[model samples]
Structure formats: C-alpha cells, structure tokens
Target: MSKLSIKPLADRVVVEPAAAEEKTAFGIIIPDTAKEKPQKGIIVAVGNGKKDEPLTVQVGDTVLYGKYSGTEIAIEGKDYLIMRESDIFAVL
Candidate 1:
C-alpha cells in the first residue's frame, strides 16, 4: 500500500483511477477527446466511517464507481479522486 501524505477525514476515500482505454475492441485507437472517463480504480486511502458504521472498504482494494462520482485532485503529480464511500458502487 502506498503511504500518502494526505488522509481523508470521514467516509471519504482517495482513489487512483484506472487509465482510460487506449483502443476499442476492433483495434481502433481512441483519441483523447473520444476517450471516456474511467469508472474503476484502486483505493489508496480511506477515512474511518461515521462513529457507528466503520468503513467496509480498505486501502489497495479495486473498486467500481459512477462515471461522475468523485472530485478530482492532484497529489505528488498524480491524479486522484476524493469521494465519499457511498460513491463507490462495488468492490472488484
């Protein structure tokens, strides 16, 4: 697991989004403007859940989320998403 300098405060998590697809099934290369946002990512950091509900997700877990789920942020020259745990839809 990576040791990040930033930590989430509540049910928020930091996710490293998977790279956007470079090509289609038919071997067509996708242009930057045509490439879609990735919805799956690996969790890098997480916050403790609310007092009563501890978070089920943990660092290093690969997860699926909505297309427009989290807020985009940059740390240490890398892109990451910070969103509430509720933004995550499922573990992969």
Candidate 2:
C-alpha cells in the first residue's frame, strides 16, 4: 500500500492500532462483543511541535495509550487513531 496522505498538525499524531485478540490463552474463542479495544499501536504519522513543546514520539514508535484517548478514523478501510502526543502513555 502507498503511504498515508494524512498529515497531523501541531502536537497531534496518527496511530495504527494493533489488532485485537480473537482467542484466549485457554483456547477459548472470544466473540466480537467480548473483545477489548487495543490500547497499543504504532505511530504512523506525527505532527510538528507546538511552539517550544516539541513532540517526543515519532513515526514507527510502538506506543500504549488510554482506552478512550484518541479519535477513531478509517483510511482505505484500515483503522487508525488520531490524538495528541500527550495521549500516548509509553513507548514499547
């Protein structure tokens, strides 16, 4: 696939969320209704710093974020999250 054309502004960032697990370790198949939202993702795009506050995260960084932190979006049928750099909790 071609590179994403979306460009975040300010301290915003674009993240591609990790896929949710469909099965448990005990071999139990989890239904879609029981699946949890992934709190982790890879940075796909980053925005420039806001004034003197430069963003610490960069593209390709695997990060953990709050469950309800970012706004969900779809690009070419793929899911992504757009949120501020502060929304990300840590880089894994």
Worst 10 residues of 2 by lDDT: 23-32
lDDT of 2 by residue, 1-47 (tens): 34789999999999998766565333434244554533777899899
Residue-level lDDT for 75 in candidate 2: 96
Candidate-wise lDDT, in order: 0.83, 0.82
What residue runs in model 2 are displaced by over 4 Å at the alpha carbon?
A: 22-38
Q: Model 1 over residues 1-92: C-alpha lDDT tens digits?
A: 45899989889999998776665443434344654533778899999888998899999998878778889999989999999999998886
Residue pairs clashing in model 2 are: none
Instruction: Report model 2's TM-score to 2 decimal places.
Output: 0.78
Cα deviation at 5, candidate 1, in Å, is: 0.7
Q: Judge candidate 1 at residue 65 and give its lDDT.
A: 84
Question: By TM-score, how accurate is candidate 1?
Answer: 0.79
